[model samples]
Target: MRNKLILSVASLAAAVSLTACGASTTGSTSSAASSAASGEVAVVKVGANPVPHAKVLEYIDENLAKDAGIDLEITEFDDYQTPNIALSEGSIDANYYMHEPFFNDQVKTKGYKFEHGAGVHIEPYAAFSESYKTAEEIPEGATIAITNDPGNQPRALKMLETAGLLQNIEDDSAALTLTDEQNPKKLKFEENQPEILVQVAKDPKVDLAIINGNYILQAGMSTKDAVIVESTEDNPYANFLAWRTGEQTDATKKLDELLHSDEVKKFIEETWPNGDVIPAA
Candidate 1:
């Protein structure tokens, strides 16, 4: 009877030991699964103009970020100044708007540490009209409407100068104000807000207007009608992703990846066929 008791107690001890081992293995597995799930997700605030810039990010936020494990949210801005301000104040993670030249001006003047990443798209500054079929049809001494704002006025003048419609204009890194001293077309310049120039371009009275790429696309004008278009191959005004200077290492790298992704490139090609909007690859 004593020997039987001893064997029974031994079997019970072995069963308890097996149960404890099983519990430990499960606990370890559960811990590992939890650790794997703990990967961090950051909310990146971004700012962009409505048409292509904002529209493009909306695509990235929905598609690209899911794979990268990033949460990109955008705050749209109509004016150029506000987006940068939002970025500076930590309201947004990054901004995709102005070209390098304009971005540099904002950083230098505002004394911020903002920096730009990969060239996403180039909304080429182009001239368009509904009144006249083409530049050849527009008469000499025509009343031309141009954007009056400092940042855009220079761009408008540069496009006109590039077309050879206007002459002897020097491209300056400093402030550029168009003078009538060498006005070859005998063009009368009517200055208005950049947004209004689009309406003016379509007006019967307005002969020709230099419009931004966004506005040009918005107005339903074609590159065929674009007397001149900014070429992405050698274009100087390629738009890029902007962020605080120090943050360019990891977070910004993810954004660059998104910009250069096949999805983005494909989207631009299919969305703006006939090269209305060109990718800055």
Candidate 2:
């Protein structure tokens, strides 16, 4: 009877232990299932400028991101330089404010291992003046304020060449610094930070100011208001999405697709009906 009691007690203990093990396995399986469900959503952090870049991303986050199983985290940068820095530093997953030339220059000069998607839109670089109503009215020897950045300086010079404001303009690469011979009008070029070109445009002393389209919009000025606007046809300055090379995920690709979607195109059209910003071809 003593042996029987001991055997029965041991059997009961074994049964309890087995039950506890089963419960633990079940709990783990349930938790894993929950985690798998949550993993379907991907969070993508992007840096952009305020005017159109952040606004466009804001539209996607509010309207489309949830359905695509993406959560867009947008950081707005007031300056042009910081977005790429943030992207390179891993502070942001991607950026959307730079055009092809600027992107290429940043990658080349800074050695950022970056890759870009198709052009999403074009903000035509434009020239604004407080004193002149038309490009033809820009006087000889006038002081024109332009961006000092290498990528955009060439663009501004090319536009001036097109307007017949400057002569003997070299190719984009060589036009960084103009010689006295290139200056038929003897126009003095005042190089300033791109963001402040709007103030230069507003200054009565400055004869002309060529400003980036994004900055134009931020200052509540329209491309239509400019005396001279860069042509959109065969334009190579379309801004697009960019990310670190080999680090691009499905979420970033989805965001790029969304940026070129019909809905986004329509949003840009209706938002800037005067052709301040055009969808890239």
Candidate 3:
């Protein structure tokens, strides 16, 4: 079922109150805005992560898409795999959560016929823990929670490697299959969906949780609370809007244009002043 998105600050506030704070679904599977003149709006159903992806699209839906005669139906997903699956199976017109490398990995592994739009935003990953105040304060045998999705798993591991939590960083971008010797602290890693990275961070039992910046923002928190954050300097993981190969719909096209617009850029810059979510070049 498609849920319609109306134009208002209240709608945006609703999204922030829910997904920004780690609630599972937002606004009940939203439908794309439709054209009244033609008697039916082109519903470009898009799947995205809840925090910034859906919020950005909602901004476009309210401010930009109405003028462009484009309607965006945003479907929210938690994990990395399902959005691509929904896009591939014709459940949605496009998606806006992952970057080039993650998308390429999905295509190569699952052979999903998908292509990307313009670069949207960069949400760096970080290590957040309620167990320890500092990185050194973390006790041995601490339980760590990371995203289980193959696309984001390496990112979590890479962040850990950079924090000196894991040594002998032979391949930071490869599959995470570390031996006992590879991890010095002998920390127990608990794999989870990317959407719950923040949830894990909130768990008192878990020592540490590696969460994405967008979710952290949704949780009414910032990367400043994290022990270690992934560097944004020439970061390769630039999130973008994507659709099926050679099948960019008119609504998707307008959305792509509006996403790179000045208003959206300004919104991102002002919303995340601490460089949690940076607009991609």
lDDT leader:
2
Positional deviation of residue 148's Cα in model 3 after best superposition, in angstroms: 1.1
Residue 180 of model 1, lDDT score: 59
Candidate 2 Cα deviation (angstroms), residue 63: 1.0
lDDT, candidate 1, at 153: 63
Q: What tens-digit string does per-residue lDDT give for candidate 2 at 1-281? A: 00001112224444344324321111222232243357665767777888788889999999888887777767676677766666676656688988988888888897989999999999989998878998789888898998878888888898888888887665463333677778777788888888888888878889999999998898898987788999999999999999889877777878899999999999999988899899998
User: In terms of TM-score, how similar is model 3 to the real structure?
Assistant: 0.78
Question: What TM-score number comes out for model 1?
Answer: 0.77
- Which pairs clash inside model 1? 45-93
lDDT of 3 by residue, 1-281 (tens): 23322222224444434433333322212333233335445566777777788888888887777777766677676556666666665657788988876887789888988888768789888888876877777777889888766667777777777777776655334334687766878878888766677777778889999887667876777888788889887887889988888877556777788899999999888877888899988
Ranking by lDDT: 2, 3, 1
Q: Which stretches of candidate 2 lie over 4 Å from their true place?
A: 1-39, 173-176
Candidate 1, run of 10 with poorest lDDT = 1-10
Q: Which scores better on TM-score, 1 or 3? A: 3
Candidate 1, residue 66: CA error in Å? 1.3
